[model samples]
Target: MTDTPTTLVTATGDSAGKTAITVALARLAADQDSSVGYMKPKGTRLQSNVGKTLDQDPMLAREVLGLDAEMHQMEPVVYSPTFVEGAIRGTEDSEALRNRIREEYDDIAADHDQVFVEGGGSWTTGGVVDLTDVDVAELLNANVVLVAEYGSPNDLDDVLAAADAFGDRLAGVVFNKVSDDAFESLDQDGIPFLESKGVTVFGALPYEKELAGVTVGELADELGAELLTDASTDAFVERFLVGAMGGDEALRYFRRARDAAVITGGDRADVQTAALD
Candidate 1:
């Protein structure tokens, strides 16, 4: 900690991959000889292992960023049972939670070179974290990195709203899962759209399935279904293309794929049949 401040990585919209981007950025800093500190300050909907809720992502960050402190200290609050319980009753106090989050953030931030603080969910989804990216950014008094999804009609609005909410604390935006077609959609309207709203498009990413992490078997577990093939266990895909192509197109790409997992919800007979085929 240099008595300055740390960087807070945030996202404006859903499925923006804030965690992945934050981890990647921290890894970048570590690569450049900076001892990076990472945190996902708030999170809900944890992955469960029997009675224990696994804090896998943060643990991974601790390993990758090479932290020496207690893992739980990095993330002081787990917005699982408590957050959901309050949210269900519609009695969750956003500002109060913000204060607690900030206090915890300040503590960890005091010792690290660059602490990367990530948010819980998108602007709309919140259980207990009391933070959208904007709220967290404001409370932390740190720079923001808004994760944006390309090809969405409301991307501009969401991104701008987050920046405006954070004001001077807002840094820039990184666009996630940006496909070639998505970029084409934004081609003419892209620069004007961002400039019109006073925002910067930091980086546009190609869709990577590994980031999603909801593998076939994992989806099977979540959906209460059995894996049809052993491939579901080991098939970690980097991306998924659904109806983007025709007969030859599907085979053309899938034929070259090795250990690609097929992830879809339960009772989607159409997808189940397709995967089986």
Candidate 2:
């Protein structure tokens, strides 16, 4: 194992694909025969499995990448409503939490040539108890890769803010879910503009519905519903169009979705059949 080489993957907002990017990087590094480790230092989404409550992403890392680490170590801090209240009241121990994260990270790093650290949410999501992405990055001494979604000029402000926040530790920014129409201008003008502002552009990936999606079967599992019709669990749903209109209008809206899932009341046979048709 090398000397705890690590990169912290963070994003601008929700659905920015931070976890997916971390997984891809870890898989690529492992393919190149690098001993790779993965960790999500803090998680907001909790899942109760086999009598243990653990965060989702770190469990994903353990299962998908075959990483050998305890789930608690992979996800040291879980944010519950009570935890947030404690943080707000200044009743939580920030130093102890930081020490726990550092000790877990050091253990993971000791066994791997490189480690990929996944941040919780946006840059400021965990600031209540000093567990923000920047805080964790500074604690771990890891470089930062900021993932951003392209929608408007305001996104540029977020990227610049991240660059200013990380400063020299900022490795680069990867634009996610960019529209095809915007791709040309972003690739041609947007990249150069960011570079001129002293922020390196790794690459802008065109928006693919599949990359930012969850399968219908997965949704059913979460909602505890049984599937009556056979649907491909691997299919990625890029959008969700509610069937609220008449058949003609509904069909028109349905056509607009690429790899989308339609949701309607079970009693609405018209909507269901229209979506099927």
For candidate 1, the 10 contiguous residues with the lowest summed lDDT are 43-52
Candidate 2 lDDT tens digits, 10-43 = 9988668888899999999999999999998887
Best by TM-score: 2
- Name the regions of candidate 1 deviating beyond 4 angstroms: 49-52, 87-99, 127-129, 152-154, 208-277
1-277: candidate 1 lDDT, tens digit per residue: 1353678776665457777788988888889988777777665437752233545667777787778766566665566765567667877766776666666666677776778887766754553445665666656667877788867555677777777777788677777787777876665686467867777767577776666455666666777986555553645545565534444555565566565554556655555455556
Candidate 1 residue pairs in backbone clash:
209-238
lDDT, each prediction: 0.67, 0.85
TM-score of 1: 0.69
Instruction: Please provide TM-scores, in order, for all candidate models, with all chains considered together.
Output: 0.69, 0.78
lDDT of model 1 at residue 5?
60
Clashes of each: 1, 0
Candidate 2, residue 250: Cα displacement in angstroms equals: 17
